[model samples]
Target: MRIRSLTARVLILATLWSALALVTIAVAISALYRQGVERGFNNLLRAQLYNVVNSVSIGDSDSLTGSPALGDLRFSQPATGWYWLVEPLGNYATAPLASASLGVANLAVPDVEATPFDQNYERYYEMTDDVANHIRVAETEVVLDDQGRAARFRVSGNLQVVEDEIAFFTSRLYAALAVVGIGGLIVNGLAILYGLKPLDRARRALERIRRGEAERIEGDFPSEVQPLANEINALIDSNRRIVERARMQVGNLAHSLKTPIAVLLNEARTLEKNQAEVIATQAEAMQAQVSSYLNRARIAAQRDSVLARTEAQPVMERLARVMRKLNADILFELDVAPDLTFAMEQQDVEEVVGNLLENASRFARTKVVTKAVMTARDDEPTDGRRGWIEVVVEDDGPGLAPDQIGEALKRGRRLDESKPGTGLGLSIVKEISGEYQGSFGLSRAGIGGLRAQLILPAVTKDTA
Candidate 1:
């Protein structure tokens, strides 16, 4: 997926939030676990201090001495990081004594004079030894027996136990949260893809509409997108209606203008010889201009209209048969592919093909060729508009130079006045082809005659 796409954006946001939530949960769990470990460790230390304080008494020499332990074997081992100490406070006539685990190391005591006692008459602090093992110390001041002589008792436990537990728990917590985060991301991605499927369907439907396969968008869309689909369908209907109305009005105007020109041609014959010829010439020119412009207007209106497909073979076959009867003296050859179709109105194809073939038949010395084939056109976009139906008409008659050929396509540009008809056929074909966004060109044919090529949109059964 593109990073800038909507799917990526949705997933990115989801993953960020999921990661944040999981991290928060992991931290909370770790915090609660550490608090529990600290409480349990402190309770054990308090018990050890109680044993040490209770075991001491005002000995014969006024010194503090105790055989105290927390029932842990590590206390008897040297430098094992578990120890208890009791010493006389305020220059009392007593010396300090400690567990065997302390060895020669000194157990630094907190200053009881500066530190306040907790509710249980005990105070706690932490210290580190030369070996870098963190140790927890719980200290309390107490008087031995009923005498006023005071003593300080302390129980030191290695903080490494709690630290190791927290480290292990933290490692496992991070790993578990990582797994959860990955799983959450996968589920989010799948949900996003499934949820956006309706949009993909809507996009394909729009493509089909543009290709003229469907007249309007049709599908079961999400509620959020259904209004957009409905709006598109409404627009397509509105545009077709507008085009239809314009075509009708254009047709009506053409007929209205043609009637007056026909009447003028008829009335000019009754005038004086000199004046009659002048009036008739002008009238005929007006009639030709009217017919030409109206035809162009009609073609432009229907060119881009969503038209029905017309089979190319049948149209060519029909034109071939009619041209044979019309040009009985010349030989006609047709080469058309089977099942090929034109994405245009049948009447429009007939007008274009009929003109091309009729002009070829008129100029041919002996034989004329009409060929139609389905081809891929590079000029059109690849989105369903790339396919084109190319129709080529060739004759064995004399052809014009390239410069004259271009001029011959101009309306009423008859190169040879001896020709029996007005030279408007090629002009009409060129203009109508252009209206459909197709192409028209003249080239030198292998038959040593002028070649007329017309390319129009092609339709297949699948695309249709």
Candidate 2:
């Protein structure tokens, strides 16, 4: 689909993509964060369990006491969420366990520590039999070897407090993510909208340019895009000047052809009967060819007429004004019903309509109506997606038959043999149309009169 509003489309897509990326990153971090917190708490709690077990001691006579109590490994007072446990050759282990699931069930506890008052321990976790709940276990052994005695010590601690701390931190993380995600999206959205303000100005400038209210874009815009607008404005000004110069050259070129045409006519007038017939025939043919060349040259020059906006209305209006002054008694009216212009050169348009308009003005009942339209030009194939301009000049003067229509478009053929015209006009229109990738033909109009129509490819600023 084509995006109609560039600014809005860009802003919307950008914001959406950014929000999605933020959410993806946040989810990944949350998962990793929970795992890290759980692992950290588990390590610290297992170490405390190992130390507490080593502090409990038992005698050969089943007497229970420690030479020195374990320090800081277990709570001083009873705690609601956690507690310590010890069992050394005792019938009942006071801890509520689902089973007696010791971690290394059959391994003998070693008495390797040389210091009697120092604590050295290894950490482990297990699920005891009675409650079948996870518990951290640790142990130590002692013997009354000096007095023919033996002893053992074992201790353990509950890990539930450490687990709860990790859970609390994880819960807070969820709330923070929600607040940050929403806040970040809002901040980013405002930044994007403000950044695209220059694009809005550029759009309005283009609209004004189309309406002819402004000649070039000149607005306070962002630095990044200002250069593009400036370049486009420069190019428009350069093209308009080139078109104006080409028109002047065309006028000079056309006037130069008239002198030679006049000389040929005068030369034919002084010839004898046999010689006059041959010379007049050759002269008329030569004059037609010359007129045709000048007309094409003029069309080429006007290709970018007022920067490819060669509306027939304005050009026809000028033609009508010129005809009135040329012959005050003749009645000439340009009957262009729909006044939309053919996307062609001013001179090519003027020549096609002007020549036929002149013909009707010379031969009509003082009535000439020039009709034109804009459609897909004939030369543009049906499969082509090109917009074209078609301009038709018609007259109620004597019409032509099917055979005469083809002859009328021939390079050197003239409809009325004795009519005053350098038969070159229509053919010139044909050549110019072809040069610009268009078509030219002759047919009958809706008014049941002679119609000359030229179908031309729309001339753009670059092509023109």
Best by TM-score, which number?
1
* Candidate 1 C-alpha lDDT tens digits along 1-464: 55868898999999889989998999999999999999999998988888887787776766665576467898888776788777777657656787888877787656767677889888888888767768888888897766577888888889989999999999999998999899989999999999989888988887676555788889888899899999988877876786677678877987897788878877888889888878877777677667667666766665555544677888889999999998899999999988787877777788889988888887899999988888867667446534688899999989778998989999878887877556778888887788777899998888988899999887764454
**TM-score for all models, in order of appearance:** 0.81, 0.64
lDDT of 1: 0.82
CA lDDT, every prediction?
0.82, 0.59
The alpha-carbon root-mean-square deviation between model 2 and the true structure, to one decimal in Å, is: 7.3
lDDT string, candidate 2, 313-350, tens digits: 77878988898788677666665535464566555667
Indicate the worst ten consecutive residues by lDDT in candidate 2.
95-104
The regions of model 2 sitting more than 4 angstroms off are 1-32, 39-62, 65-83, 89-120, 126-216, 237-288, 301-306, 317-342, 359-398, 456-464
Clashes of 1: 0
Listing every candidate in turn, what is its Cα RMSD in Å to the true structure after a full C-alpha superposition? 4.1, 7.3
